[model samples]
Target: MQMASTPTTGDRFRQLIRSLTGISLPPSKVQMIDQRLRRRVVEYGLPDTEAYLEKLLAGELPQDELPRVIDLITTNTTSFFRESEHFDFLTGHILPDRLAKARAEGRKRFKLWSAASSEGAEAFTAAMVLEEARRKGAGFDYAILGTDISARMLERATAAIYADEQLTTVPRDLVTRYFLRADDPSMAGKARIVPELRARTRFRHLNLMDKSYAVDRDVDVIFLRNVLIYFDATDKEQVVDRLAGHIAKGGYLLVGHAESMIVRHPLLRQVKPTIFQKC
Candidate 1:
């Protein structure tokens, strides 16, 4: 008796994922993707990765499935205040001066966008800073909007729950003032952001690859940190242009400390390391 061969479904699946997401999957990632999407394959009644790729190629999967694929692909390594210097730049140099100038011009409100907000830390961190400014009588009306392609992470962001281990980078003062320690014994070592801080920021589902994004025209700042490394050069350009389009004139674009726009984009000018001003 002869048995049917179990095909190299994982390798083919990796290729399909790379084609769609521009994520170059290595042989080492085969098992990772298989584990992440095995349930989806089962749920779809697909026999193997080949069949799954066929469905994705044919657009037969539900709309939400694509983001699930993105979730599996995009690396979202982030923590509360993971890159602290950017926040320092915001508080010390950017906010104080931008707020003063806008107030003098009678512009009473501002908006900020955290374009690749993962797990809500960056957005909420912005809120904490803005809240402090507001309390100090800076008198600038402000709100922060955080968007990401990962629905799973966005759900966690909305829930505002975190283990103490996840918050190692957050400031001690913020941990004390903003997060309520979970009282239940089983949930000890966990905390939730206080309602006031949570209320100050909004989370939304946004895909960088989506054809259109309706960002507010007068956005004062955009933080799209540490996300461009995944995209190819062309994708990097497009995403930069899209995110930069939302910046109000004289507003700034902040990328990761190691990321840059030195690639001849006509719409931006470098004002500082990893910072660009919309022209």
Candidate 2:
């Protein structure tokens, strides 16, 4: 009789990543994963990605190392207002309607969640636009929550610091209005979200795979863009359904343009190609 052979380090690594984050690692991602984890392999003096995975899966490393591993493996690509049109709809359609309803209902607070916020850019972008509305006498207050699987990203998000290049997509006036340059000589090119806007925004570490999020179920809008592309069909569906549950009735869910065709949940109705409204 033949003995059963153990799965390769890459196979177990991929499975664990999917189980933890619902992110699929296709064959095409093999090179990318190895590339991303290369630093960790060297840092631990491991022979290769396989060795690093063995240590990680066996819990042989520090208690805190697993989170750091997840951070390195997960992709976090974002920019301020990467999809400008989303912000346009946000300020033009959603805000007006939500604000009007708020005024009529005697409510002052509005909430927006960046479901996969990376380094706080999207959340801060929303903050900038919402703050502008308040300045124009929209007369409503808002709080923004940014959640990511990467603690490294969340820490940077909480810091609210951004490089100058990251502000290119942000309009000049808004940049001046919302950011303050770092005084530290070592951080010259970086700027941070001003106190007022930073005060209204917060970041937390969250895995969308969790059965329930520790977020407000009455959230007004959720920007769950870009991140779903990493998930498989089943995982993607589960994530959307879970996200939809957190949205208040009549609130909105925005996905990436590439993911527009993928949003098909019973609780959500497509009002636009990439925009869905909760029923």
Candidate 3:
């Protein structure tokens, strides 16, 4: 009789994760994976990681469970105005220049994309900057689109509610203008993004590994920050190449400072340490 080989727990989990989310977790991260998925394993009433892996590999797990698993394993660490310099550049140079040219060309709309926007902070920050520009006579209408792979994160983003600590870097004037203090006594230390800001922003679920992007094709700026570190070099190149097709001529791409090593594409030239301009 032929013997059937069984995959190790780490092998099974890694394969399942890559298949579902396209995130490749190395074997060294096995402990990290275990810690992250422990809650899910308990939540599903599975006795142990082995049981959870069995159901996941056998395709017997509920469809919705996959997103929840993704939520658990994915890191959604972000804060308002997390990368302050990018916002400064956007408001100080790019928006002003783009608005001036758009005005001369009679184009009145601007589009910005926060490609890996985590829990809406980056997108809202962009909106606040754009609104400030408008208030200062930029004379262009703008919209912001935020996309992420985590449905749970998207739900939190759609709510537009944030904790007090998250606003540490946000200026007092902009905070007063763009946020409403929560009235509920129990929700103390929390604030919600004002309706005007929310009105100018939208959120959607997106996976960068997909063959094509589902976003608007002519975006003027894309903030694909911080998220590229999770992808390998090949995946990074594929994502940047695909994202390049969606950017309008002369549009810009902003990445996190730590992601500078992998930000390379034939059509994009590095304009700053962490910013690229489409040719």
Query: What is the per-residue lDDT of model 2 for residues 1-279, given as tens digits with 9 covering 90 to 100?
Result: 999898787888889888988888876788998898889889989998878888988989899987887898888999998899999999999998777777787877999999999899999999999999899988788999999999999999998888899999999999999999867896799898999999999999899999889898888899999999999999889899999988888899999999998888999999999999998
Candidate 3 global Cα RMSD? 2.5
Worst 10 residues of 3 by lDDT: 13-22
The 0-to-1 C-alpha lDDT of every candidate, in the order given, reads 0.79, 0.91, 0.87
Give one digit per residue, the lDDT tens place, for model 3 in 1-279.
989789786788787777666688998987888788898789889898878877887779888877888898888999888889999999887787777767777888898999988799999999998998888876789999999999999999999988888888899998889889867896799899999989989999999888998887878899999888888778888888899999877888999999987877888899899988888
Q: Per-residue error at 113 for model 3, in Å?
A: 0.2
Ranking by TM-score: 2, 3, 1
lDDT of 3: 0.87
Flag regions of model 3 displaced more than 4 Å: 1-6
**Decoy 3 TM-score against native:** 0.94
Name the best candidate (by lDDT): 2
Off by over 4 Å in 2: 1-6
lDDT of 3 at 257: 90
* Tens-digit lDDT string for candidate 1 (31-63): 776677778889889897668866876688898
Best by TM-score: 2
